[model samples]
Target: MAKVDILNTKGQNVETLELNDNIFSLEPHKDLMYRYLDMQLTNSRAGTASTKTRSEVRGGGRKPWAQKHTGRARAGSIRSPLFRKGGVIFGPKPRDFNKKLNKKMKRLALKSALSLRLSEGNMIILDDISFDTPKTKSMKEVLSALDLTSKKVLMLLPYKEEKYENVKLSAKNISKIKVIIADNPNQGKTNVDGLNLFDLINNEKIILTKDMVKKIEEVLV
Candidate 1:
């Protein structure tokens, strides 16, 4: 088991947690990480870009001219490529940007990301980042005290408003800092605080609780 020092919201050391070394201490798989991240990003695409094709364009139902008259090339419809106001021959269209992954793949991918975080020393088990008010400066102070200032942070909380709301908001003003609520549903939803590993995988602190540690161990084991 790997031991991690737990810190409270005050940036003081609280307790230490014993994490499963198998899960948190494994070597990160680069290929699996790439696949997982690719799937996540692909699923988030809207794929709604569409343009009117010649067949789809209106007013093209009628023939502009005879096939061999007027000394002009055979003319079909007003939407022909030779016409000025014609529909696009080749154009983008709406599509589904989702990638299909098995339940196991998702679980494995999440575990992989978590493993990478641990291997890179980016995971932090904090008691929580509770704040009674939305004091941005105080939050900054707390982050600095934790030596996380200037770091793109991804603080996770067990539940919202119990703690870390102000800490989450305070990160809004910081250029490279971010705080995320952990355990939110992963049902292909996006959070402005970054819902995917791609957005927060860099230098953020992925906060974990004792319960979260247990859950991760249970899954990875």
Candidate 2:
């Protein structure tokens, strides 16, 4: 069994939450993690970059010169690539750069990412992160206590409820803080068959729950 030091609202240790060895203690597949990270980065790329080709450029429909030129090379049109106003040569076109991974591979990648957090002591277990009202200042205090003022912080709760209203409202406005409703981000096995788990990589802090920990553990292969 593995254990993660549990913390309270004050950023004080409550206790070590016992973790299933299957989830938090296993070795991460370096290759899989790397591959998933690479794919995620590629998929995130807009890949909308494009340029018009010479002929694709507007105007220049009329021929600039006839077959017989005045001691100069014959020109087909001014927009020809051969000329300054010509369309681009092999210009880029919009494309999908997304890389797909098998459901199993994606799960493995997410597991690897989680495992990394555990090993690095970046994973935190909390009894529960609740709020009485939507107070940005209170949430800001939580961030400060965790020393996550300006870092990319991901706060996970066990489930979704009205209690999170304040936390959500408080953190949502801040670009650096992201509060994930457990019910949403906890899509444990929705697409377990066809996954892109690479999205779980590089997060600064991970909240640990027995249920989520178990799910992440079950997919490790």
CA-lDDT, candidates in order: 0.69, 0.67
- Cα RMSD of all models vs. native, in order, equals 3.5, 4.1
RMSD of 1: 3.5
Per-model TM-score on C-alpha atoms? 0.81, 0.79
Model 1 alpha-carbon miss at residue 86, Å: 0.8
RMSD of 2: 4.1
| Candidate 2 accuracy as TM-score | 0.79
Which residue ranges in model 2 land beyond 4 Å of their true spot? 182-201, 209-221
Residue pairs in collision within model 2: 53-87, 54-87, 54-88, 134-166
On residues 37-147, what C-alpha lDDT tens digit does candidate 1 reach at each position? 888889889999998888877674777777774898787788876678778877889999888767666656666777788877887787655676666787788778878
Candidate 2 structure quality by residue, lDDT tens digits, 68-90: 74788987788877877568888
10 residues in a row with least lDDT, candidate 1: 188-197
Counting clashing residue pairs in each candidate, in order, gives 1, 4
